[model samples]
Every structure is written in structure tokens, then in C-alpha cells.
Target: MTIEVNNESGLEIDERAVLDIARYALARMRIHPLSELSVIAVDIPAMEQLHLQWMDLPGPTDVMSFPMDELRPPSRDDEEPPPGLLGDIVLCPQVARTQGAEAPTAHSMDTELQLLTVHGVLHLLGYDHEEPDERTEMFGLQKAIVDGWRTEQGLEGPSPAPTMT
Candidate 1:
């Protein structure tokens, strides 16, 4: 997979970790090896503009996914999914930092960003949490992927569990 990260958030973040986690999530989802994805980190103002324009929300959120080809994970009996543009995941590091600070768990902004990265990946692959059942499935899968990545990286911190609220 081709995962490109552009950090324009004017904040220092582990862009490599974001890239790694996004790639890891795609791999876990069994996306095509030739699939392409873009992870862009923007400032609060830019994120707010996007939020208002795309989602019609009032403020900047942690992450927003804009899928292109609308790809889904291939079933076990199906062939590998075709290569396509998986889409863009816009991240706001400033917002993420604030969220991390507010979370019950004590963890770094990087960990929060990593979790958002995986969540964005899932959204690009047609995962959502608008409904209760959707929330359960999407958040559960997201937690599992993030925990697995953290374990593989030998990272030590809280599990970054979903808020579940």
C-alpha cells in the first residue's frame, strides 16, 4: 500500500508512527497491496473549515475520512480487493492533543494519533459508528487493531480503548 503523510498542523508529531499505523491497519484489513492512501495533518482552522464544508459540523474534530473508491475488505472466499485510491484521512493534531489530555487514560499525543489513524483507516474501508451496533463493531475492531499494533511495537501505555459512550 502507498500511504503518504503530510503534516501541516504546525505541531510536532510522529508522522512516521501515523504512517506506520495506517499501513498496519490496511494490512490487517487485507486491502490490496497497491492501494493508495493519504493522511494529512492540518491545523485547527483548516480542520474546522473542512468539518463545516464536508460534514457541516461546527468545530474541528480529531479526524475525518473522505473515501474515494469506496473500497471494502474482501471476504475470505473472494479474491483480493482491487487496487484503488482508498481516500484521504484528515487529522488535527491540536485537537487530538486536547482530546488526549481530556481522556481518562494518561497517554501521549502520539498514541491518540495512532488510534485516530486506525479509526480513519476503518472509515475509509466503510466502517462507521453512527448507530449503536455500528459503534460496537467499529470501535471493537479499531481497539483490536490498535492494541495489536502497540503490542507489536512494544509500546507501553494505556490500551487507548474506545470511549464507548
Candidate 2:
């Protein structure tokens, strides 16, 4: 899969490393090659605006997903994509940094951003975390994917504990 990451955040980051995380996440989900996913890192203003417009909330969010296949499924033949555009995952590092104060520096931001990308891909696959049960299932899958990636990378941190609510 072609994972395209856009550094719209005005901060320097290792694109290759981020892409590696995305690749790892996608592989775990059994997403095949030629399926492209877009990730955009943004600043707080943009994130806040999008959160307000899309979710009717006033505060900024860590991520927002715009699924290209929001309602339609790819055709049978086309689904074997050598080139299928999944959708867009917009993320905010500033918001992530704000979230970081709640935990460790790098761990919180990176894990949350990675979590959002996986969540975005799941959203593309028609996964919704709105209701209670749905949130449990979706968050469980997200934590699993993130934890697995960390284990493979030999990253140090507590595996996010599963939350029932």
C-alpha cells in the first residue's frame, strides 16, 4: 500500500519513520498493496476548524478522517487494487503535544497519531466508534494494532490498557 504522509504541521519529522508505522499498521489489517492512504499533519487552527465543522465541537481534536468510500464499496475486480485510494487522515501535532502533557512526551504523541491512522483506515473499512459497543470494538482493535506495532519496533511504553467504556 502507498501511504502518503503530508507534513502540513510546519514541524520537522522523519517521514520515513511515520510511513513505516503506517505500513506496519496496514499490514496488520491485511490491507493489500496498491491501496493508497493519505495522512496529513496540521496545526491547531486547522484542526480546531475541522473539528468544529465536521463534528460540531468547539475544541481541537487529535485526528479527523474523511473516508472516500464513505458509503460505496469498491467493485469486486477493483477491490484487488494496485491503486485504490482509501481516504484522508488529518492529524494535529499541536493538539497531540497538548495531549502529551497528560503522559510522556514522545510516547503520547506518536502513539495517538499512529492510533488515529489505524482508526482512519478502519473508518475506511466502515468501522464506526460512535456507540458504546462500537467504541469498545473499534478502540480494542486500535489498541491492538498500536501495541503490535510497538512490540515489533521494540518501543518502550505501557501497552494501552483496554477500556470498556
Candidate 3:
């Protein structure tokens, strides 16, 4: 998969780590390797504008997903998976920092951002948590993917789990 990250939040972040997490999540979901994805980090104003415009919420949200092509992972029975544009995952670092502080998980802002990135990608992959069962399935898979990535990076394991929005 081709993951593109554009940081316009005015806050410095580990861009490579974000790309790595996106790649790992897509790979775990069995998304086609040739799929394209974009991760954009924006300032609070940008996020708030998007939130109000798209979601019609009052303030900036941590993350938002805009899917394109509505691509789904190829089934095991399928012979070849076709390449497609996955979608755009918009992230707000300022919001993420605030949410990270309040999160039950005692992780750094980077980890929180990583978690949100995974969550956004899952949304792109057709995962939703609006219902209890959906929440269980989506969050379970998210934690597994994050834990696996953290282990691979030799980082300390996660703290208390953060509630997914």
C-alpha cells in the first residue's frame, strides 16, 4: 500500500511512525498492497472547520475519515485483488493531545496519535463502532494491531485502554 502523510498541524510528529502504523493496519486487514491512502495532519482551525462542515459538530474532533471508491478487502477465495484508492484520514494533533491527557491509557501523544490513525484506517476498511457489537469487534481488532506494532517496535505495552469514539 502507498501511504502518504502530510503534516500541517504546526506540531512536529514522527511521520514515519504514522506511515508505519497505517501500513501495518492495512496489511493486517488484508487490504491490497497497491491500495493508496492519505493521512493528513491539520491545525485546530482546519479540524474544527471540517468537523462543523462534515460532521456538524461544535469543536474539532481527533480524527475523521473520508473514504473513496468504497473498496473492500479481497476474499480468500478471490484470485487477485485489484488496486484502489483507500481514502483520506484527517487527524488533529492538538485535539489528540488533549484527548490523550484524558484517555485512560497513560500513553504519550505519539501513541494516542498512532491509535487514532489505526482507528481511522479501520473506518476506511469498513469498521464502525456506533453499535455495541461493532464497537467490540472494531476496538478488539484495533488493540490487537496496536499491541502487535508496539511489540515489534520493542516499546512498552499499552496502559489502560482508551475508549474508541
Q: Write the per-residue lDDT of candidate 2 for residues 1-165, one digit (tens) a residue.
A: 778899899865556656777788666666666677888999888989999999999978877788774533344644643345678888787766556546533345665566566666677767787798988887888788877887888988745443112
Candidate with top TM-score is 1
Candidate 1 residue pairs in backbone clash = none
| Candidate 3, residue 139: how far the Cα is off, in Å | 0.4
lDDT of 1 at 160: 74
Q: Clashes in model 3: which pairs?
A: none
lDDT of 1 by residue, 14-120 (tens): 99999999998999899999999999999999999999999898988899999999999998846768999999999999888887777888567777899899999
Better of 2 and 3 by lDDT: 3
What 10-residue stretch in candidate 3 is worst by lDDT?
A: 156-165
Candidate 1, which segments miss by more than 4 Å at Cα? 163-165
Locate the minimum summed-lDDT window of 10 residues in model 2.
69-78
Q: Give the higher-lDDT candidate: 1 or 2.
A: 1
- Note the Cα lDDT for every prediction shown: 0.89, 0.70, 0.86
Root-mean-square deviation of each candidate, in angstroms?
1.4, 4.0, 1.5
Q: 88 in model 3: Cα distance from truth in Å?
A: 0.2
Residue 71 of model 1, lDDT score: 94
Question: Which candidate comes out best when scored by lDDT?
Answer: 1
